[model samples]
Structures are given as structure tokens and as C-alpha cells.
Target: MTETPNLKIPHGGYVVVGDGRRALVLRNEGHALHLALRVQHVFEAPPNPPTREQGTDRPPRVRQGEHRSAIEQTDWHTIAEERFADEVAAALDRIADAIPALIVVAPPRTLASLRQALSERLKRVVIAEIDKDLTKLSIEEIGRRLTDG
Candidate 1:
């Protein structure tokens, strides 16, 4: 009797999406080809505040006790952006460590930004950009697209 080849693909990497509140970690290699609602992580975005002039007429000051908390609650948008990028970058880094090739299909803008932020080593990997929101799609549909491609 012939044995069936264990075409099991290893964990390719994690897929980080959403506004950091919702993300997916696709471990198994064929996961992207087999996941329906690809959400595995949900985290609150970090807090960031805008920078003020270094030497202002009146230097900014805050009570010691309130300083920490106050500073933490400033620019939410910047905080979210940084945190999201950091999380995604970390996931992609792990993926790069595992394989010689990786195909990243995200919105064109996101793909461009991520491509620029990747390390030199990661840049060596095969990165493809596709404008599709995979979070809403099913594994079967994704598989069909892959096979068709």
C-alpha cells in the first residue's frame, strides 16, 4: 500500500490586520489557503501624543502624578498607527525567518508602506501585493483564487 504524502505545509507566518483591534495569526503554511474568518488577535491600540516645541515661551509642565497618565492619553491616531505597524512588522519578521519566499497581499497603500519598512533580509523574500480584504473571505474562495492564479 502506498502512503499519502503529508502535504502539510508548516506555519508560514501570522497575518496582522484590522486597526490592531482585530488581527489574525496564520500559523500553518496552508492556513491562508484554509481559513474562513482569519482573526486570531484583538488588541487595544497604544496611546501616543503629538510633539510640542522643545523651547517654548512657557515650557509645558504637569503635576508629577498626572504626568504619566496625561502623557499616555494624547494622540490616539499616532499611537494606533505605530502600534499596528509594529505588530504587523513583527509578524512578518517571523515569517521571513521561516521561509525563503513570502507573498504579502494587502491593500496597495498598506503593501507599499510595509514593503518600505521591511528589513533588508525580508526584502529578499517574494512579496506580492493584492488589493483584497481577506478577513471577510472564506478558505474555499481563497483556495479557488490561489489555484486560479
Candidate 2:
């Protein structure tokens, strides 16, 4: 975590806490002053190893004229993370109709991916975006952080 923003999650508001591998959606059950979050949905992606482990063959060779050039190896881990972002966006779209407002919390890189995956209507529902990885924190601890931090 870098900087903690002042946040007040109103009742019926939703918070999407995620990173590259996990996305946890929580709904606020209490008022703005007292935040009590209840887990509504969770998306946990399968473990994605590094490119070296996931890739079987070496970099592909491109033939140009008489010389051969090796293309850069693909990053499987980054691809998996991007796909995970799409899944999270779909989940948020599914629950958007029920939420009054939304707050998104993710690391800087994941946040950009999520922002791109989310729909226009769903984007409008987002009231705050906190660039931090709060997925590992307990629900109680998250609530405390939102209210106190």
C-alpha cells in the first residue's frame, strides 16, 4: 500500500478488491459512517507461472532474406492476468444493477487492466478507485482500513 485515500462506502455500495489473480466483491451493509462489508462474490484464477515455465519451445525464429531473427518470447503470465481482468469486469457487470455505488481497489498495473475491461455503464457506477492491493486482507480488516485509514 502507498497512500490511503479518504473513503466512505455508503450502504448498498460495492467494493471490488482485486489483483492479478483474485477478485473479491463486497457489499456495504452499514451506513456511510459505519462500513460493514459482506462478501457477495469471489473470483480466484488458477495459478499462472512465469513464461519460462509455461512456454515449451524457445523463441520463434523469423526468416528475413538469408538471415534469421529470433522473436521475443511471449509472456504467458501477463496474458493470464489480462484474462483474469476480463473475468473480474464481467462479475462486476453482473452485480452492477444491484449496487448504488462502487469502489475499485487494485495495484497500479491491475487497475489499468481492470479499467480497460470494465463496461461504460459499469464505469459510471464506480465512485472511487484506490490503487492498492487489499485482496489478502480479511473482511473485518478491510472495513477497518476503509473507515480508519
Candidate 3:
């Protein structure tokens, strides 16, 4: 782990943590903190092929039963990871520069991935890791976990 300097700890507040592809915004409530998780997707627009009849009045034809399931697909995990890494790097740059003393709380895997990608100076920033899976739990449940911890 790279040594980060001037780590700042907050008394209490809300922070949005995620890898861009997935994110959880944790906010402190009066009793407990609420966690709102979000998932983002980077979609590539398909190119429209040039046709000789560009000015034709014919509309695009619809192919029934030709749809493919985008769900239940892991073939693009690597691609998503790469894109997510890029997004994380950008976000970290902003965070490290703008909020040098911000306290970060995240899951173990997320912390590990962020640690590996963050700079030595940024690594010095303090973070708290919670093992709970925000995606699988409700906001109220996440708040309970945070308060319970």
C-alpha cells in the first residue's frame, strides 16, 4: 500500500462510494446513516451503415424474435472493469484534490481495488471498510449496519 500523508478524518457526514459502474451514497441520519446504491452502464452506440438509399422513404424494418438478452451476461466483465477503473481514477483524482481530508467508507473489495489504483499520497487517506453488501440490502438495513458498527 502506498503511504498517504495528511489523512483527514471527518466527525460525520455523507459520502458517495463506488467504482462508477456501481455506487453507494452513504449519508448520516439522526440515528443511522442511509445508503443509496446506484448502478451505471456505459453503452456504445451502434454505427449506422451507409446505404445508397439515404433519402428513401422506407423506414427501418423491425426484426421480431431477434432480440438478445443483455442481462445474465458476464462476457463484458473485463471491459466493464476497465471502464470502471478509468472512472474511479478520475473520481479519485477529484476527491484527492478537492477533499484531501475526506473520510471514506467502503467494502473490503472496493477498498482493495481503490488502494491498488490510488497514488501513494492518496493512499495515505484514511478509509473505513464495512463488509456489508449494499447492493443486497435495503437503505434502512444499511443505515442499521452503519449505526450498529
> Model 1 segments beyond 4 Å from truth?
1-22, 25-79
Give the whole-model CA lDDT for all candidates, comma-separated: 0.46, 0.86, 0.44
Weakest ten-residue segment in model 2 by summed lDDT: 1-10
Give the number of colliding residue pairs in candidate 2: 0
Model 2 residue 57 distance off true place after TM-score fit, in angstroms: 2.6
Using TM-score as the measure, name the better of candidate 2 and candidate 3: 2
Give the distance in Å from residue 68's predicted Cα in candidate 3 to where it truly belongs. Answer: 34
Q: What's the true lDDT of residue 8 in model 1?
A: 20
Number of clashing pairs, model 1?
2
Question: Model 2: residues >4 Å from true position, as ranges?
Answer: 1-4, 65-68
After superposing candidate 3, which stretches have Cα over 4 Å from the reference? 1-16, 25-75, 100-109, 136-141
lDDT of 3 by residue, 1-149 (tens): 22223322243433335542465544343321333322222223233234433334443454459763433323244345455545564565555654333333445655555555666655564455443345446555644444455
Please report the TM-score between candidate 1 and the true structure.
0.48
**Best model number under TM-score:** 2
lDDT of 2 by residue, 30-128 (tens): 988888899998999997776898785788899999999999888887789899999999878886788788888899989889989998888888887
Better of 1 and 2 by lDDT: 2
